[model samples]
Target chain A: MTVATAGEFGLISRVTARLGAASPLVQLGPGDDAALVAAPDGRVVASTDVLVEGRHFRRDWSAARDIGHRAAAANLADIAAMGARPTALLVALCTPASLEIAWAEELADGLAAEAGKVGAVVVGGDTSASPTLTVAVTALGTLEGREPLVRSGARPGDVVAVCGRIGYAAAGYTILSRGFRSPKLLVEAHRRPQVPYAAGPAGALLGATSMIDVSDGLLADLGHVATASGVGIDLRRSAFVVPEQMRDAATALGVDPYGWILAGGDDHALAATFPSSVRLPDEWRIVGEVLPASLFTAGDGVTVDGRRYTGGAPGWDHFR
Target chain B: MTVATAGEFGLISRVTARLGAASPLVQLGPGDDAALVAAPDGRVVASTDVLVEGRHFRRDWSAARDIGHRAAAANLADIAAMGARPTALLVALCTPASLEIAWAEELADGLAAEAGKVGAVVVGGDTSASPTLTVAVTALGTLEGREPLVRSGARPGDVVAVCGRIGYAAAGYTILSRGFRSPKLLVEAHRRPQVPYAAGPAGALLGATSMIDVSDGLLADLGHVATASGVGIDLRRSAFVVPEQMRDAATALGVDPYGWILAGGDDHALAATFPSSVRLPDEWRIVGEVLPASLFTAGDGVTVDGRRYTGGAPGWDHFR
Candidate 1:
């Protein structure tokens, strides 16, 4: 219903219907102010993200559909990181009342498009008038009788493995930052990331030790696993750059690939510490190992290469 | 820590403590860009809402704390309406960076206060720079073992009942519209809504024929139920409007008390249809009966009291 190519129901109808077609956890999907999600385990996995017009996405940088995808991908990745299967999504959008209605619809199209990739669907949301376009999304996932994988579960000597690409989102971000104009792959990465949507549950199925989504840089995110587990994590520079997709934007930007690989964020990749014997998925690779709290030699929470990445740009700080 | 009443910590400290609170359902709560929610029943319920500064609330009209409470209440109440117990909340805030840190903190206080009432904790959220204050909340709920109660379950011959006050919110809104000066009761209702949070699950337990939260005016909300259920609902205006409270606001607004009683919305009350043999709770009163479609009408495509309330203000359109 949303315009796939040219003429469609615009963004509202198309995206609404697309989401509607999915098996809803609740009794309803879009068209209402909110969607209903079901929780059978007497528990639910929930998360939210808000994308501002200029802060999270740029109209000049993305198609409306792509924006929707980015929003869904961001939130869905959160649910996935919990080792939960994404069930539904709630989205509230605020934009200038005069903005193209089609644009809003397209955004939904993008959202449905991305959500479909992981079998997640938009359930419900709100709309309002505002000077800037703000998209707030909440993703829900089912635990499916499994214990949640938490950041605190990492223990010393647990092997740190990633289920998706790191630094690629940052690498993609670097390309956009340099004012490059191709706007295909990198821009798509920035707009709609293909996070290892299923890898989260895969890790959980394998009894993952601890898990997380890589929205922030690997160092910072892994640092959280360290702090939560009350242990330390030491990255192997050797294993850090094994992935080459990270090199594209690094070469283009003339910056150290390690920074993006280690400190760049927004890939929505899944990172978890597993017992050394746990088998990892194909994309997954050993990046580090959990250490005793006193043994952390990264020295004051710097990247693997010992480069400090903090302050306003230490990945995506909401306030900064 | 957000008010003069007690101890508070830096944002970082507060976020840190909340992150570790253990719950079997929560794989993650905070310390990252997003938190994970476990879906029981292999499904999850998701919904989102965005509140604008002046359009949704006026700083002069409602305390920042109250605004925070209302924002959370609105969405949490929605999840409840689906017969779901609220589990986690994600918030997105966009405000003028120059706003006092206290304002933001106070807002957080309000959010935590109300979220506590629903047994839901704030999990994770994003904060950013904006010209105006914006609070967007996404609430997730678990359905447990029962099927979700939806607006479409009502059938002909079902008894229509309500579990909370119908027009109190509209009455309160009227007071705010008249100029933020009103009795404490009226002002409080506008600032903080008291929803029948328990009744939603109760409805599930009671085998509600169909249900919906009375958010947009009783008639409007019923219309949704009727449309969804493919049935008609005939309300006995006589059932609504008890003396003390209705008189209290009516005296202030000096309008027909019935206007607020029937046309006003945002009460967050639960309206449901049930079998006639089911004993209703004292907190609820039977107001109508579901009939075959085309049996009742209000305004436009709707009918109330043989009079159509067709001055379409548009019960909250999306994208403003």
Candidate 2:
């Protein structure tokens, strides 16, 4: 049935009933004006992101469930990037009156599935009718007595590392944009990102100094770290392993795979810096090194080896 | 300059720089992937709401600053309705690329102003370019060792009370819809609601067993309390003191003021139930009583003067 036919209260009941009881972390759940969650350590890590239908995802390119999963991943990755364990998620969804109830249910199913990956719950959310579809997710996490990882903490002598896939989503995006159907796995990577949730808190425990999630492309995200820490980052081109799938897709599209590797976003990978003396975990691989500000011009926040990236930073800009 | 000219990072810096330092509740703030907020009591209350540009507000009807203020109030009121003190707000805004940079700056200004009312901070947010404007806000609160006031706790003999302005915003909506230019106060109320921020925690301290914000409408909100508590709510018609402004506007529109009083929403007033023997604080006025479930038909969740509301509860419905 369409949501418009079933009505608001009925739709809320159906969605909440499908969501089941709140997890143990939630002291109070749905049916209340707000959900109460246990924050244990007297602190909570919070972040939010909004996904517009056409701008963030295409209905034709993504399933309802995939859209939901991707939205959850984006916010959950932010919490993880802060070196906190994700505890709960609150979703605010906007859709049109003609939307099917099944679509929303599928979206909820996807949200629950992704949230369950890290043992978090969908605590509460709001739904409204709009001319277009938009999904806004807010993820909350608990530090569990550990200090949060911030971008500003990176030191000049630190080693930069990344855990999880890079350039795959970009490859997927290119394949889809070019209407090439091959490379199914790369397309899947663009649809549902497998964010490294465990690696975040693990990195903090392993004495990582600073961390960030790869949402706005690697170089763009690391640029945030560089500016915040007042240090320059020098990435080794040889350290990156170009997957056969990305290479194939790049060949098919006649575009440089390295561009996607450097600029592609939505991968939700963990980019962090560790002290030079610390042995990095198996989940992380060294990709670059943090350098003193004097090593590069201020305009060149991140350098590819000793030379500046002549192509400039390849990244997503919301307004551009 | 437009956001398209300044770029995403530049726009974010402009907004955050204007916001200045973080509040005491925020352990970490902007520039990080996520913000860390002190929750003190080990429990956090969270609520989220999405406001679509045309559905919730119009750029022509309200200023950009007012839109931000209203969005903050909507989510903050939900936290207050749950009987918690608001701590922080995370905003996710989607606007078109051609939006003036001044509009975004004014929006941040309004957000900061409203958050400051309850000593809450705008810790972090996401911005993206979309075809239309949408503002989604999530408010986090601390219980501070108090149990949240859920809807299920009202007893048969409990007194129904209300705090803050009721029916004003709805009246304002009616005025604006009909194209009446006079009664500027009512119009202002509709543009930016004055939610009773302190009354929530105060109600909890005074032993409010059940509560909800009047965003949907007096009768509609009370109906939730009734259904959740498995009791009937009987409001006294004469108890409500019609404001001179509302009365003047109602007369001008040739509509029953009670229609606005009973049905008008977006007022964000506090409606709550307390034990019959307790004296409500000055902030609250006794407006009704709780009755046994057997008192009326199952469909008559809320009544006025011991009779089922014949006009069919006036309230906002998203799909309707």
Candidate 3:
């Protein structure tokens, strides 16, 4: 979009018009120094992500609605990764003035739509004219009377499990890279991810030790847990679970399904170290184990027998 | 600055090296799904603002320190405007990968420096590679037992007052626009504004009827109060209590001093309407009264010797 000077209808003004107080948690909305939210509990889990046009997303590849959904999703995923219930989001947008008003409205619509999915609200935001479009979203969540699941809590014998889809966004990227229109399912996943919002809080309830969301590839993100916890991780590849459809899609693209399962990212799946005795939910696929050493390698029959998963996975690296 | 690919030792990794968990509010800093914050009050006052490379600032005109300070100040000012005690800030930054690590470090220093002034901390943030630099900050404030001051409660005959500098930014812009590089004070004022952080909670304590920050010139922002609260506003031109230093600067530029006071934006001073009997702060300048009607006009303002003061105040107009 062409860059225009700040118009009569600027971003901050438009934002004030499009929303109102929609929840009890939001005691105040846009027109204040800060929004007063009913935290109910004393602790708040907050996360922020920056999405720049031509970097995090391409406008040509995604709709304005998708941008809004994805923008909120990115930060919401972070809150979930911390094993916290998603609550409210504050967005800051810098867009070229000449961009269509409809783009922004649709983005707001997408924002509201996605926010409604997790029972969260858009509390406050700021906007201004800029050369390129940029969105910064901050998500706040409540712990609801529980200790936060930190990345440094994993132990030697904990079970490694994952909740929600893995590799869908990466698979979708392959379609985009090949210049082929993704099947409706893959493209939808690429635009707005379906994060297990309940799973984070649930994992905490089920005694999750160290946890993280698969924003970067599973291995890279889990690598963080291992590094932080001072332990090694060993994956059992044979025990890996993939839906029939995702497996079929990987087969059709002539790519190794293991890569998507092992390295693909942005599915926002919840991965955690659970106690060996606990029974994980059917949605959560158990595929690995925590070990004593500080290494990431394959175990008995997985990618293993002897193979080691060295280096980082091919995920969304901001600065490679 | 050259644009580096994802593989370069870009900002995210560099920032990771410079950062530590220095604040108590930040339970989790970087390298986690999201940061865990201690919302001890069970309520949070949140606000967000986006600063672009050109529209909000100029790299050539301001140092990286000033840019960082200004960016954090803008959002923190919003929290202060809300009658909330500033607590922590989450920053999402997009910059050219080749931008000096020292520049990024200085920017971080600037953010921390400003946050320190208000007793706030940088709890969480994300960095990404982008062509042009952009900074978006989401400030979280803790309202320690106070009702938030909003812009929808003004009443007729309420005394309107401003706490802090009004036209200094505009005056500085005039100097910058005229290629005057010798003066340091005007440039410093333009780059780093000293917002009255404590005045907001004080105003709230004094039972302010309505409030807003003077980000968009005094009259223009006050216009929002008139529009939202459905009250007319009239100012006393004779009540101009501007400092003498500003007068000298305006004279040096051969520009009308009232123009800066009226139309210049980005001062971020607090403007509120309170009962006439309220004890005023030293920083506050009594400027006008809330009228009974719904529209704003010159007749509502103060006159000198039976004649209206016709000196023009070019309230900042975004469209213009």
Candidate 4:
């Protein structure tokens, strides 16, 4: 049955029934006016993200479950980017009344599964009927007594490093736009980002200076850190080892893989700056270094091999 | 300039510039990946609400500022209903690209102004482009070491009370629907609800057994409390004091004011059950009494005097 037939409360119950056990941090769950979550560190970290159909995703291209995973990853990664452990999620969904109830149930399942990866739970949400389908998620987390790893901590001489996949989702998007789906790995990455959630707090524990999730491409997001911290970032072009599958996909699409590696977004990878003397873990691949702001002009803080990137547009903007 | 011309980052900077000083509870505010808010009580109370254009509010009926106030009030009231002091709000806006920048700025002003009423601040939010205009707000609050006032705690001997205006917004809505706007007080109430932010914690302190926000009319919401608490609620129709203006409007519209008070929605009044021995403040009007579950059949737990309310539809259902 469609959501319109199921009605608001009925659809809500059907979807919520698919969720697993609540996180221990949740003092109260759904079915109430509000949820109570433990904030043992005396502070709570919160972030919000809205995903609109056709703009952020298309039902024809993604399953309901994949969209749920993508939405949850988009916000949960932000919490991790702040060097916090995600604890609870409050989702607000606005869908057309014609939406299938089973689709919404699978969406909830995807959200629950993704949240489970980081020990978080979907504690509560609101639902409404609209002509457009949109999911707005708010993630709340705890810092565990550590100072938040903000975008303004990168200093001169700090080494820049990244963990997890970087350009796979963009490559997948390119392939999908071309009506080709043979590269299942890239296609799946585009549908559901594999965010490196653990690396955020790990970077903090290891004394990383600053960090951000790669939602708007590496260069574009790094530009944000550079502007916030008043520093310049210079990347070593040779340091990036393009994966075999990505190179293959780029070759099939007749495009340079470097463009995707440098400018692609939605990978949800963690990019961070650390003291040059800090010994990094195996997953943290050093790719660049933070430099003095005097080395670059305003709004052009990121350089490739000591020069401005001649590649395509740096990142995605909601409205261009 | 329109949001498309201003771009996402430009629109964000423009709107955030209109905000006042940050709340003391906020350790970090907007412009970061996430906001860090103080939760001194060791637990955070969170709620989310989504308001869609045309469904929840109309541009011609309510100004952008009023829409913002309404959206923020909806979520903040949910937090208050849980007996918490609101600390921060995270808003997500999905708007068409052609939306005017000035409209968005004024909307932000309204959100901030309403949040200021309860000492809460808009800490951070997300923006996206959509065909529909929607505002989803998530409110975070602190309980101050008190247990949450849930809806499932009422007993047979508790007294049902209400704190704040009931049926004003509904009356205003009816007036607006009929194209008669002379009742300025009721019309403004429809544009923006005057939520009793402080009464929630006071109710909890006075040992309220059960509590809920009246977002779905008195009888409908009381029915929810009765169902959850496994009790029955019997309201005295003679106890209601209808304002002269409302009665006049009802007469002009050829309707019953009692129907508006008992079956109309969106007033955002707080309804709670207190022990019979508790002396309620003047703002809280005792309107009903709680009875044993055996006194009523399933799904018919709330009665007016001694009969089921046959005035009209009891409440709203989003899909139905």
Individual DockQ of the candidates?
A: 0.38, 0.85, 0.60, 0.91
Candidate 1: stretches off by over 4 Å: A1-15, A24-43, A204-208, A236-254, A275-282, A295-313, B1-28, B31-46, B142-144, B203-207, B242-256, B275-281, B295-301, B310-320
RMSD (Å) of each candidate, 1 decimal? 4.8, 1.3, 3.5, 1.1
Q: Which residue pairs in candidate 2 collide? A: B263-B314
Tens-digit lDDT string for candidate 3 (B24-46): 66666666777766677788888
lDDT of model 1 at residue B80?
Answer: 83
**Could you give the candidate ranking by TM-score, starting with the highest?**
4, 2, 3, 1
Please report the candidate that would top lDDT against the real structure.
4
Q: What DockQ was computed for model 1?
A: 0.38
Model 2, span B1-320: residue lDDT tens: 98899899888988887666468888998779999999999999999988888888989888989988999999999999988999999988888989998998998888888988999989999999888789999999988899998988988999999999998888888898898755988889988999998999999999999999998889988988988999999999999999898888888789888888888889899999999888887889999999999988756489899887776455887877
| Cα error, candidate 2, residue B218 (Å) | 0.9
Query: Which residue pairs does candidate 4 place in steric collision?
Result: none
**Residue A171 local lDDT, model 3:** 77
Q: Docking quality tier of candidate 1? A: acceptable
Q: Name the regions of candidate 2 deviating beyond 4 angstroms.
A: none
List candidate 3 segments past 4 Å from native: A1-21, A242-245, A294-306, A310-313, B1-10, B16-21, B294-320
For candidate 3 chain A, the 10 contiguous residues with the lowest summed lDDT are A297-306
- Given candidate 2, what's the lDDT at residue B150? 90
Ranked candidates (lDDT, high to low): 4, 2, 3, 1
Clashes of each: 29, 1, 8, 0
Kindly report which residue stretches of model 4 are placed more than 4 angstroms away from their true locations once superposed. Answer: none
TM-score of each: 0.84, 0.98, 0.92, 0.98
Per-residue alpha-carbon lDDT of candidate 2 for residues A118-149, written as tens digits (9 for 90 to 100): 98988999988888789999999999999999
Error of 4 at A101 (Å): 0.6
